[model samples]
Target chain A: MVASFGPVALAVAIATVFGLLPLFLSGIIVPKKPDSVKNATYECGVETIGPTYIQFRTPYYLYALLFVIFDVEAVFLFPWAVAYRQLGLFALAEVAIFIGLLLVGYAYAWRKKAFEWT
Target chain B: MSFLSCPFPALVCNPFGLARDGIYGLLAAIVPEPLPTVALTVLGIAMLIAIIALTVMSQVWVERRAVAFLQERLGPNRVGPAGVLQSVADVLKLLLKEDLIPFKADRATFVVAPLVVLVPSLSVWSLIPWGPGLAIADVNVGILLVLAIGSFTTLGILAAGWASANKYSLLGGMRVAAQLISYEVPLVVSALVPVLWAGTASLQGIIESQATVWNVFVLPVGPIAFLVFLIAGIAEVNRSPFDLPEAESEIVAGFHTEYSGMRFALFFLAEYSNSLAIGALAAVLFLGGWQGPILPPYVWLFFKAYAVFLILVWIRGTLPRLRYDQLMHFGWKVALPISLVTLGATAVLVSAVQGTAA
Candidate 1:
């Protein structure tokens, strides 16, 4: 298993160097022109008001919860799908029940407005 | 041409395989055990980097000119012939520009965000099968690894947003976190249809299975899987129509709002690389990757990837961006279910028709 991934490890290693080369070069080749005003956070031309890192309330929180549940469920689906030809209809029944349960949760979330963009 | 005389008639002739065997044999005969391996490894790395640099340069130029053609304008015609060297100039200017960091930003995370964003795109390229015997990784769980690595972009985007310490950037980051994760379900599920039909998650395995017939032509679920995969893929790359995070008119450059100079260009580079990854995957999973007659297999992969990317550009030119609510609602309500049903349908239909028969 580890031997098969040798080429993949090499590929990632090569890509990391290529990807980070420019940022490294930019630091050496380009001079920094930073100043207090120039480095301040942007908000159009107006001076920024209020703290930029204040506690934030987001409507996406419920969706985030939904994502965690569904994403985990997908982990099982992928393997089952890959091995479907080998797995008999009994395995299909198991996947169907699992997917059916998830769909119930999906509909429940819908009814509960977990996906609402409030 | 020399590799065409390969002995196995049942298996298609693989030029890459022949070249690899020839070089390895020559090097091993001339040198000791470890040295030949090291030399070949270094050569492969050099070739990989060269290919990436060339791909990025050409992809950016093609996209700009294509989008320009769609908008009825000449793009970068002032630069080298037909503005082909425009990206080279742009890269030089970006390198020359002063790098800036916001005063209140989280210094470590701010510096690391672009690198994180870039890794997923780079990592996926390793596993994608450009042709038979052509993938760098060629591992068993190749497609699974792709979905796993490709999901890391959200972390980078959110980090950029939070580290920037700007309201709009945070909002943009939040949108990306939601958007990428949501679209991912459909993308993964649609990809599952091909995996289920082909009975393998190795990208090369899927491509070889399509040697006789491509996935897009399979009855019932093939076209549906392709359709969902295309939609979610466009969203996954943050292209137009699903570009809520980069909605410039509303939030101003999205998560990278405060980035400038090469740092910003790195983000841009990663985004384009991700788009290429999507095109490559779509080509492999749907368009009979490297399966056309007559041409070298790798060339077919290139042409197919280019055609898919051009379709993306066309859609970018034609479609209007979706509203934020509509985007999220549609992902959960529409795309997700369609992909799931297709997956289930493919399992039942394929099993009944072909699984037990085998």
Candidate 2:
């Protein structure tokens, strides 16, 4: 078992070294030529505008929260998919219960104007 | 019986074979018994590496051609006949291109992001069963494993965006994270219908059960689950309509804006490979993966996966991307409710049928 892990460990080490070595090499070899124009935010070469970092709307975060809930729900599907055959009718019934709950959540989100395009 | 005609007859005299045996003997000297398992482990790793690399490369070419055809144009025909060598040419270009990292970027995380994208993408394949008796592991929680590993890709995308220190990249990453997370709910709920029917999370078990009748035909809710899986998959891979993160017109390549050359290619490779991975998962979950007459199992697996990929490419070419709000709305309000209801109904019907069967 120890021997079995040797190659995998080696592969990971090699991959990590290759992935990171280039960054250090480039930093050392490449000339540092910083200028105001070079550091400017990219927006098709217009003059300096207002502050680039502004607080974004809270709606985006709400969307993200909703996303987390749904994503967790999606994660449950994989196991369900794998075990679909054996679960048979009883299993299906259980899923129906799960889905019913999810639907309620969905309906709640919908009525709250979550889908409205602003 | 026919020693002269038999291939590899020289195996009787092969020194390398002897040397290999000698090495095994030496290892045996250190630890007794189970010599073959060590050799098998090495072979398995090699096979996995080769399979993942080959799949990623071939799928890239397939996607380009499929997208081109959908758009009514020839894609990469100049590189090789029917663009067969397009991916190969791309590999060379990526190899030759100078890898550039922005000075302002988070050095460690930016570099780590691509690895994050790739490793999880490849790892998910460990659970997929291409054919009967063909898989890396036949775990009972194979479905859960896939879901768990697949979600890591979103983290990788976010890491890329945040590490880049570019506003567009940050916006793109945030959008992708949100989209993937939201759509994941319906996708999972819908997927549960199949699990409820199958009763085991082993992929091989799913295929074996479906051998007689595919779930698509058996359950009305199965198709609904399939649709949810497809849409969620598209979002997961950031392909077309849901590809808000890499919206070239607006975000200037999104999370990967500051990346160049090989580093950028890593993201590209991950994108194409993830597309294939998700497509394959969809096939396995809903389309009866490698479940067909006559052809070999792996061939059927590829055919189904490629078919899904073609559909993705078609959508990419045919549809316009949804705005951020519209994207969120559709997932939360539309797909989520429909899928949830579908799951509930499937469960009720399945139980009633079981009552009858019992």
Candidate 3:
């Protein structure tokens, strides 16, 4: 398992360094001049009104929670798929159970209107 | 037919292997034992950077020209024959411009966000099979890795929007995050259809399975999965129609609105590169990567990839930007349901066929 990650780890390190090169170069190559007005938050040529940070709706969190359910379901399905041919009918029934449980939760979420946007 | 007479086979089968092996040999000569491996890895990354830049540049030009054609106008015909060099000129201009970050912007996050967006786009190419021997690293769970890595772009966009300290940017960033994550579920589920059908998650194996007939021909479910994958892939990459996050008419420039100079260009680069990467994955999963009669595998792979991308370009020119509510509704309500059903159907079908045959 460790050896399997060798190439991936190496690739990531190299990619990170290469990816950052241009960002580093930009600081050196380009001019950096900042004034108070120029650096201020952009509000379409007008002074900012009130606080900039707005509170997002609670519905987004609900969407995220619903997403986690499906995401985990997908994760469990991956390994079952790879060894699919070798697995007996018993294993298939287990997966069916797994999917059924997730769908139950999905139905619950739908009834609660977790999917509905306010 | 004598093997000696077939001059094109070597070149066609593995065009990149010679250069890659040469680099390895050079590393062997210069670097000591353990260091050579790392050096070769670094060289592979450097080559990836070059490839990303070239591909992104061409994609930008192609997109611009195609969109222009759709609009009844001539796109960039001045600089180099047919204005192919226009992207180069654009990049140079972007590089020379002053890098600016608003004072209220989250200083560190704003500065680092572009790289955060870019690295994933570059990294996903590692698992992609260019030809027979051209894959840099053939990880067993290639599709999973691609999905996991591809999601980081959302993090980057969130960073850009939140850091910008601008309302529009913040809204754009949140929209992007929501849209991307929601679409990701369907994308992964749709991708699983091919994985289940091929019985291996490795992209190369999937391609090999498609040798006789591409997966798009896999009756009833194949075309459905392909369509779902394409739509979700488009959203995951934050392209047109699905690009509610950066709707220029609605949210100005969206998440990257506050960004300027190379920082902005990096986001642009990441966008097009990710577009190509998504297109590449779609071609591999459905259209059959590097698999065709005649022409080199790499050539075929690129041809198919560009074909997928051009269709995206056609889509951008054709469709109106989706409303944010519509985007969310479609992802959660429409795409998720279809893909889940398809995955279930595929699993049942595969098991039945193989079990009966056994």
Candidate 4:
């Protein structure tokens, strides 16, 4: 396991250095010029209207949550597929049950209007 | 035939005997056995680093040229032959640019998000058996590991978008989270077709089974699964036609909008490298990975990988971005059901065949 992770650790370290070091060097090398307009949020060429930060609708969160549950469940299907031939009918039956459960969940969500585009 | 004059001279000279004698001499002199495992580990790390670096650089140029060709314009031709060095030049420019951090952004999470995206993308390569006995790990759960690591990328994208503290960034993050999670199901389900056919989660075993007849030919459903996998994989990586999160026209570069210089570059690296990862996985799972005549295994592996990468480039150049609602609907309504049904049918067929065979 240690040997296997050696490359990953090195790659991460290199990526971190590549990402952070240049930024640090630039801050020291470049001149800083500050102004109110420079720091203001860019909204095309038009004058700023309303606050830049505002609370978004909750539906987006619901969509994302639903996505996660389904996405992960989907991932579980790959391994089952790989072992499909070996699992034979038994594995197929098991997956059917799994999909059935997921469909039920989907139906409940649909009934609750989780997917409604509000 | 006279052994001395024949090509069997090496055998006649007792090469093994001589080598054994030499080893005995070395043992007498207190020499230890060379650590082949350590050497192999070091070599694997070096090779992986090189692969990641090259994949990122080459993909940048490929994407630019592909997009340019599609738009009927010339892309970067001055720096090197056929603008091959354009990506290198971009790297230099990024290196010189100012690194900016938004004042309101969460610094730690903001800094870590890129790493989170990049590291998993790179690590997935470990489980990918490039050729027989060529991979870093031939673990039985290799396929599972790849899926797990692939999904972690959604978290990274969300983190980058949320921590940036910009409205666009937050929106981008939410979009990415939804997109990635939604497409992941179809991707995994499609990948399962091969595993089910091969009956092993080990990548090497899958490829070995394809030696006689490629999986693409074995089942009529294989190509469909490959297609689904490719589409979903592209969406997972947030590429064109599914790049709602980073819709530059709308989100101003999306999740990494607030990032600059190297921080932004990390995200770029992650995105391109992840593309290569998915491309490679697709080639191995669907195409006959490293199973061609004449050429060595590693060479065939690289060819398949590059070919898949080119396909991605072609799609990016040819296809327009899907509307965000369309993207979501396609994933949930279309891909999910298709994959689920495909998986169900595949299961039934495999069992029926096994029952007959047994």
Candidate 5:
């Protein structure tokens, strides 16, 4: 039964090698002849312009922040769900309260248009 | 042969189990103390990798042929009798191409990014229950483990995009992160339907609970949960029209734009493998993993998975990609609220039924 850990550990270890194998093999098998022109940042053969990193719009960050709230809500719900059968009606009442609190936050977000992409 | 004694539905008439036990007993005796376990582990892991690698190769071929057929093209029929060897040929070609590193790119991170993306995608396949006693491991937290490992793909995409130092790659990476995180809400919430109904998170246990009726047919919210899981699963894996992260026309291959040779191939393989993994998870969770009256359990599982994949391909062939804003809107506004309500309703209904019965 200890062998059960075998696939899991082996997978973790093998994942690195799996990722690295092609890179390593390509390093050995493939021919590399690099020049400045070939290695330049690809911009349709035009001269590279400003810095590659640009400031993204604020909407992305807003979306991510909202996602974090829902994600945590999901995590909290999991334990409640797994033990829901044993928890009885008291548990249902607690969940109703929990969801109400989360809904308050959700309603606020909706009213504020945080869900809007623009 | 003692290991064969484990009570499992499949083992009752399983020829594979009988044959596998003979090898297990022989393997157990052939090695010295403490070494046998390690040897078997190596053998098991190696076989798993081999199976997955072969599946990935064939999957690439199937996608090409299926998509081509959908588009009324003949597709690759020259290589190895009906293009069966096309993926193998493609692999050779990929291996021989120059490994390109973009100017000003972060070398170490760029080199490692594809691996990071691919490793998690492959590792997620380990916990899938192909049949009774046929999974790699049935960890109690198997479903949670899958959801957690799945999120790692987004991180890997972010790393690839940032390390490339390309504007397109950065956009792709950010989009992947946003999209994946948003979709994870629905995925996890819908998945909880199965977990809650089955009263266990173990993949096999969920399937066992569905022995009489699969979750998709089991009442008020089962179909709703399955549909939510399906949509979220598709978005989770970055398929069209949800594939804004790597939208080809807009971003020129997105986060992987700067990658060439095997590195790009790794990302490609990871994408398809992730698709397959999500399909298989859907099969296990809703359609009843490896459960059927005719054929074998694993066969049923594969049939359902490939059916899911075919639907993905059909969607790809028919639908136009959504805009970035539209993608985010769908995830946040549409998917999130519906999943939350469904979860609440399911909880209430389940409690009502169970409360009365008790």
Candidate 6:
């Protein structure tokens, strides 16, 4: 396990450098003369709106809530899969039950149109 | 025959591996333990990152020209022999542009968001099995680790959107968060099927298990799982027809709307890198990583990965962008269910087959 993570540590360190190097270089090399007109929040061609922070009736939250639940359930399948060959039929049935139980919630979500973008 | 001629059987595919061993051999001969190993690992990862950059640049050039060909237009033929140096030129210009942070944007978060987006995407490559025994880390829980790391991009994107303090960016961020999370379910579920099929979480083991046949050829379940993974992957990277997040027509560039210069370039880098990563992961899982005849294993991996990516480029060129509502419905209602069922069925069938064989 320790051996496996060696590359991960190295890669993270390298990628961090890769990610930051350009920004660091650009900060020094790039021209920066910030003016209010230039730096104003992009609004295409429109002038200053009523309030920049507009309240949105995002229908995505329902989907996000469902995602939180189902995504966790999906995570649970990983260990079960890795150890599957030895699990035999009994564990298969148990997993079927497990997935079946989750599908109930999925079906309920579907019935309630939790997925729909209303 | 190949092994007889070359002592290192996988030398063609495993350059980093060879380099690591060679580094350790020379350094160990000269110095001592642990330090040489550390130095070798650092060098390997640095090389890996450099190669990823080269691949991403090539992918950028290939995509523009390929998509243009799809539309019967001559694309980027000017710069250095069929526009091969176009990405290089674009990078140079982006680096010199005025770095601007929007007046209302959260200064620190805005600056950090691109790095947050970029690091995880690059890190995913370390665990990818390019050829047999070619991965930097053959972690036991490779698939799970990959999914975990890949999910962090959503966080970075949300930060970019929220930090920008712009209405369109905020809306785009929220929409993207939902899209990514919803698509992730199918992606994870389908990814795990190959693990269950191979009976190991090690990506190299999974690839070796597919030497005789690829996972996509498995009857009943393989094609469904591959289809689900592909669609979710396209959504995962915000590619069309599911690219509603950054739909230029609707959102004016989505979460990165307020970003400019190197910051904006970082986001583009992350996006393209993630797309290429998705292509690679798909090649590894479904099409069989580094498993082919004649060509070297690493070369096969690259061909398969680029082939998958070019298919996506074709998709981007051919298909119209999806409406946000349609994308959400497709992810949650359509893809999620299909993948879930397919995974369950795959588990059952694979176990049954193994049981009988035993």
- Lowest summed lDDT across 10 adjacent residues in model 6 chain B is found at B1-10
Candidate 5 lDDT over B22-99, as tens digits, reads 767887787765665555555555566667778889888888888899899988888999999999999999999999
Tell me the deviation in Å of residue A97 in model 4.
Answer: 2.6
Please give the distance, in angstroms, between residue B291's alpha carbon in candidate 4 and its true position after superposition: 1.7
Candidates 2 and 4 compared: the better one by TM-score is: 4
What TM-score, over all chains together, does every model reach? Answer: 0.93, 0.80, 0.94, 0.84, 0.93, 0.95
| Model 5: number of backbone collisions | 0
lDDT of 4 by residue, B1-358 (tens): 1211213233332323355455556555664544444444445555665677777898888778878898898987788999999888887777777656555668899878987887777767767765555676666767777888778888989998888877788889988987887787788888887787777877877787677677777676777788898999999888887889999899888898777777687788888878888878887888877667655556677788777878888888888888887887788778888877776766666676645222
lDDT of 1 by residue, B263-320 (tens): 8988988888888788889988988776777766777788887788788888998899
DockQ per candidate, 2 decimals = 0.67, 0.32, 0.61, 0.36, 0.63, 0.72
The DockQ-based CAPRI class assigned to model 1 is medium
The positional error of residue B175 in candidate 6, measured at the CA in angstroms, is 1.1
- Candidate 4 residues lying further than 4 Å off, grouped into runs, are A1-53, A75-87, A111-113, A116-118, B1-39, B356-358
Candidate 5 residue pairs in backbone clash:
none
Could you tell me the lDDT of residue B193 within candidate 3?
89
> How much lDDT does each candidate structure score?
0.82, 0.69, 0.83, 0.73, 0.82, 0.84
Error of model 4, residue A65, in angstroms: 3.7
Candidate 1 ranges with C-alpha deviation above 4 Å: B1-35
What's the C-alpha lDDT at position B176 in model 5? 90
* Candidates arranged by lDDT, highest first: 6, 3, 1, 5, 4, 2
C-alpha lDDT (0 to 100) for residue B80 of candidate 6: 100
TM-score of 3: 0.94
Which lDDT tens digits does candidate 6 get at residues B171-270? 7888789889989999999998899899888888788778777999988899999999999999999888987778889888889888888988888888
Worst 10 residues of 2 chain B by lDDT: B1-10
Ranking by DockQ: 6, 1, 5, 3, 4, 2
Which pairs clash in the backbone of model 4?
A81-B196, A82-B195, A82-B196, A84-B196
Candidate 5 global TM-score:
0.93
lDDT of 2 by residue, B168-228 (tens): 8888888778778777676667667667666666666666657666776666777777888
